[model samples]
Each structure stands twice: as C-alpha cells, then as structure tokens.
Target chain A: MTGSPVPPELYAEVLHFYARQMQALDGGDFESYAATFTADGTFKHSPKLPAAQTRQGITEALHEFHKKFDGDPVQRRHYFNHVVLEQQEDGSLSSTAYALVLTTRPGGRPDVGPSCVVNDVIVRDRGALRLKSRAVDHDQEFAAVAV
Target chain B: MTGSPVPPELYAEVLHFYARQMQALDGGDFESYAATFTADGTFKHSPKLPAAQTRQGITEALHEFHKKFDGDPVQRRHYFNHVVLEQQEDGSLSSTAYALVLTTRPGGRPDVGPSCVVNDVIVRDRGALRLKSRAVDHDQEFAAVAV
Candidate 1:
C-alpha cells in the first residue's frame, strides 16, 4: 500500500480500538467486545464455520467460543502483530494482522492454541470506528481443530 | 506516543524489513535472518534466557532454536501484528508488536507455539534499517515454556 502518511489521530484511534477490543475479549465481556463492531458486522472464525453476522450473532458466537474451554480452568490470551492498515478506495479502512492464541490450564504449562491471519474492514459509524467485517483465516491444519 | 505523523517512507521501510525477516525465518534461512540485525544487535527471547548479542550470537541462537524441534518434520511460521512504530528522542525508531509462532508437524495438526510481545529498537546504518535490540516478553506461563 502506497499513500501519504497516515494521520497520527487515525493511527491512534485504531490502536485504541484494538486495545479495548482485546481487553473485552480477555475479560470475557462479550457485550463490550460486540459493541466494537457495527450492527451488521460479520465475523468469520474459519472457512468451514458459518460466519457470525450482526451484533447478536457475533455475541453468540463468542459465547460459544468461550464455552469450548469449559470444565477446564484455562486462561486464554490472544496476541496480535504485523497489523497493516490502509484506506480503501471506498474511504473505509482495511487491515491485515496475525494472531496467536495461547491457553494455560490451572497449574499446567501453557499450550499453543491456534494461529490465524485476520483481515478486517473498519468503518466510521456515529463518530466511532467499528468493525464492518472480519475474516479470519486459520492455518490449514489448525482450521480443522477450530472448525 | 504523541507527536507528528511518522514519515511514510520510514513506516514503509520498517514494514519491508519485517517482511524480509519473516520470510527468512520461515524459509529456515538463518544466514538471511541474521543479516536483518545490526552487527551488535541483541535478541532476548525471555528474561531468564541469556541474551544473544552481536550478529554471530544472534545467528547461533537461531540455529539452536531451530534444533529444538529437530527429529520432527515441522513447518514453522511466524505472524506479527499490532506493530506500532515511533521516533524516539534519540532519533532511532522504537517499535512494539505482538507475534504468534506456529508449528505444524508432518501429518499432525498445527499448534500454537508462543504468544509474545516484541519491543524493538531500529537504526539505520549504510542506508538500511536494521534491528539494534529486540526484547520479547512472553506471557508468564508461555515464558517458562519458551526459556
């Protein structure tokens, strides 16, 4: 992507948005996490899994995601890196990132959970940046487990 | 974190450097990977592990790192995101990012290896961007496994 420098304010806003989104997910606050997206936002966890569209759908999907680790007191942490944001021709922002998910059981060693690539479209709504669509591509082998 | 916008050229350069570095590591080309750093560059995998200083030291450490997964035909992939770069007071560039290391063994499902935070100091010498220091902070439990 080639263009003029990204404004500091825009970069700062995107950074802040991701921080809040991560905190919400880590704290199990699905409500807050869902709020980061637009009303018609869409989340694709993997190619095989049906996409979660709309705020309610996203929230339910996240709830089910959290339930996967039920019966085991495991802590989940997500790390993101190599985020590249660019302004699309339509004026919305498009982003690509990589994610690492780690899980640790009580008194047990940490285990790698999954690694995936994230592609997102961000739009401004009501004066705040929100996710329009997020398509996550999991590694081929990992996608089998994730789905 | 508050200042004028980062020059587009500088931002592009850092992005380009990381792309090359990741390619080298994924391709198991230690020679190319080691060349990404300065002569006195340092790599700190974790607090408990001894730091690797200088070009030779960094290359040797990577060699040993790759050896750990020996005897198993595995593919290693590194994904980075949330990269934030700022100009430091000393005129060098300081960057903070998150990384996901994934490994896939032959006929086995892909697994998450480690999720860590990467802090880097980048400098220009001979007209190319090179890493001067890279300090990685893994999650508490992950750090134990990494070291």
Candidate 2:
C-alpha cells in the first residue's frame, strides 16, 4: 500500500519543535525548556524513574537536576538522531525520537551514554505548538562515572 | 537547519510495527503482542509508570492487564493517527506518534479516551526491524477508567 501523505506545515512545525527541544536542553536553558510545556504539562524520564507529572513538578525536578550538573565545568550535549512525527486529532501531535547524550569535563574526552527513545505529546498553544508531555526510554544503564 | 530524511524501509517497518501493535492490543492477540518484542525488550506504559524491563516481564504484565480488564467486558480500540520517523546511528530508528483509543462494551456505545503519545526505538532484526523499546506519554488520565 502507498504511504500516507504528510502535511507541509505539520512537517515544518515538527522539525522546528524538535530542534528547539535539543537546543534548550544542550544550552541549559531550564526556563525555556520548562516553558515548552503547557501550564499543566509533564515530563516523564523513564519507565523506572519518577515522572514529573505536572509543569510545576517538572520545574522543581529540573531545578534539582541543574544543581547536580550546575557548574559550566565543561560541556553537555544532546544529540537527536532519528525522529518520527504523527499527527493526531485537532492539531495535536505525537512523536518518537532517539537521543544520544555526551557529557564531558574540561580537558577530558566525552563519553557516549546509552541510546534513548523519547515519545512526546504536543498541543498548539496560541499560535505555536508546545510540548505537553515527554517520555524518555533509555536503552542502557547510565554511567556512574565517566568523562 | 533542515530535518533529517527518513529511509523508506525504516518507515515501512515502523508503520507495520505500530499497526501490528494496535491490532494485537485490540484483537486480543497476546501472542503476537509478545512476539513483537526482542528476546530482551522493554515496554513502558507511561514515562511515570514503572517499566516492564524484560520480554518476560512485559508478557507477564500484559497477562495481568488482560485479566484485570476482563471484568470490564469491553473491547479496547486504539488507533495511531500521526506518525513521524527519524533515522539514527547503527541502522537504528526512532519515531513518535499520536494515538486515540476507543473502548466499547456489549450494547454500549464506544467512548473515546484521552490522547496518548508514543516514542519507540527500533533496530533491524535479521532483515526486518523489531521494537527494542517503547515509551508512552499521555496527556490525560486513562479516562478515569480503561480505554
């Protein structure tokens, strides 16, 4: 069977949205990252990890995350590889993507982390689409210590 | 920057996989559902919910899920609406999509459940791609009931 056709606007929006997410994460712009969610949005890290069920919850958790990795000691990177977007009813969108992250200390070689699969729900807020929720599925265990 | 291109084979595999997943869930083909995973795969219901970390763990959980919903005596119908695909390293792929579920009971009208987002990681198994992991994110509660 032939594949379904993709809407151009939806396509463009999905790409832009994905980029913004990675940029915000890599840039350590917590406020921008938090703003991507709806006022009542959530962020779910993994199946076994605790989930931030609401916007406020996510903000609080992010604060904690930043505290641990707070120093601009070196570099933190989020790499987006494969991404899939599906349109839902009423302008809502769902997407899946793979992310590879590397965190390194100054003058140290970067270590590659486990592959991650992410699922996200997005809604059109005002005139732009914003993430409503994020679910991260990690394929391997996190490294306890590495540069 | 432009979005990355999705390979045709990868796209087909994803479409087929999700279709199978929807069919299995709705058709009550637990065997097929179990077959979709790798020998050591994981299934996460919601990022917040505990994940089924192993193939057997996921299968056992589904069995429990089936029994719990049996008393409800209803058919759970789920559909994948929008789908987006992204390619990654090592021939792996990632995707995101939106889902709408409709549940119906005998002599009862179908009720629509809140929307859901799906993120999946896929790897080429032999010649075809199989699900390595799935992370589900939802915007609404389970309609306060099953759907």
Candidate 3:
C-alpha cells in the first residue's frame, strides 16, 4: 500500500496506456483496443449492460457498439479526465476516471453523449500493464437518443 | 524522484482534503473553503475568467457566485472523480480531476450544470496539504440559466 506521489516513469506509462487505448478505440481498431486488456479481462459498459469477459468478449462488445450505427456517418470521441490511480496491497492498481463521450452526425452539430465514471483494476503481466476489470458507471440512464 | 506508487498515507490525505473542501463549500462555509488554499493561492474558474490570486479573492469569487442566485432556492452538488496526483520535482503535487456540478431548483428534477477539468498544484504547508494554484478548465461555457 505505497502512498507517495506516483513515480514519474510509472505516471508516464499510465498516460501512455490511456492514449494508446483511446487511439485504438477511436480508430475502430477493436483488436488493438481489446489487446489493452488481459486475456481474461472483464468490462461493463454500464450497470444495465451485461459484463463482457475475456478478450474475445471485449472485441465483440465493441463491435456491437459500432454496429448500432452501421451506415450513419457518425464521429465519436472519448475524453477521459481526473484519473486517480491507487496501488492496492495485492500489487494491482485501481483507477477511477471520468469519461465524456461526444458524438457528431453529418451536417449536425456535435453534442455531449454521456458522462461516466470508469473504475478499473490493472495488473502487470509480462512487463506490461493490462486491465483486469473495468466498470463504467453512468451519471444518468442512457437515453434512446444518445449515441 | 521516487518511481514508486504514492504512499497510502498521502493518498488518504488527498482524499480527505477533497472531501473536506467539498463539504465546506457545499455547507456555505466559504471561509473554510478559502482556507484550504495557501495565502497566495490562485484559482481560475475558466480561461475566460481572471484568476483569483489571493485568499480574499477566492472568497469574493465564491460570494459573487452565490449572490447570482440569492433569491432562488437552489441546491448545488459537486461531484469530483478521476483524481490523478503526481509529485513534482519541486515537492509540489500536481493533480488532475474531473468535476460535475449538479443543480436542482425547488420542485424541479436535478440537472447537470457544468463539467470541468480541474488542474491543481498542491504543497505541504505546515504538515497539511494546501492548494497553491487551481486552474479549472470547463468542458463548455456555462449557460446563462446555470447556477
């Protein structure tokens, strides 16, 4: 349970992980995004949605998210802020962050989609940090009109 | 520079600081809230606004904020999440957090007010953490109707 400020090197690594993960997801590279997690990683987009466990499951979930708007020329951007990381006694890292999703439709102004609280458990595996579990809690229930 | 995870003690202190600061502000104890800053602390609510550079300036800003809705019975709640703390070489701690402000008017359902990215520089003054500078970057400009 170390509690000094996060070391510079580790801080850089954590930021790097987030950047890479966001880039992969934004680019629609599901495979690469899923690779950011552990082989048995689990992710819950919302409490109402079923948890996706396993790398394959994560990839499929992402596919479904994009599939909903298959033909629409929609652009989506995810912004994560206020990331707090704590190392647990068991040597895993616990992270909490706020996420804002923006959606823009063709010829339409961009609008804020949903704000979420993201909680994650990360572990070092083979010299790299990978997410073991991720739970996304939304500030409000998803609206039908949301992206 | 220590490359280790933040100590548990400092982590607990940081959390405590936020909890106390929020409670003080929500409770209308502007003095206590302003006291959380150093004598020469600075806070910029938004890039478009001037920075409040002194403890007296901070109090005045809060006073003005509350004065705007003096006659309305409104409830305001601030939710901060994803707090990331980094220790700097100069012994100051740099933190990044996401803030969500919710406002509810009498007999009205609660609505989200504004979301912000909070960047703060904290220093240990007399064995307690005090904010030296706080720059709040808003995700969007505030609407006239907002609290």
| C-alpha positional error of residue A54 in candidate 2 after TM-score superposition, expressed in Å | 35
Q: For every model shown, what is its TM-score relative to the native structure? A: 0.59, 0.48, 0.61
For residues B35-126, write the lDDT of model 2, one tens digit per residue: 78777878897756787866678878778777977668888987664465667776677776655567899999976543465788888777
Q: Write down the TM-score for model 3.
A: 0.61
Worst 10-residue stretch by lDDT in candidate 3 chain A? Answer: A102-111
Candidate 2, DockQ to 2 decimals?
A: 0.01
Query: Candidates' lDDT values, in order?
Result: 0.75, 0.67, 0.75
Q: Between 1 and 2, whose lDDT is larger?
A: 1
For each candidate, report its DockQ versus the true two-chain complex.
0.13, 0.01, 0.03
Candidate 1 lDDT for residue A12: 56
Candidate 3 local lDDT, residue A9: 54
Candidate 3 TM-score on chain B: 0.89
DockQ of candidate 1 is: 0.13
Better of 1 and 2 by TM-score: 1
Worst 10 residues of 1 chain A by lDDT: A1-10
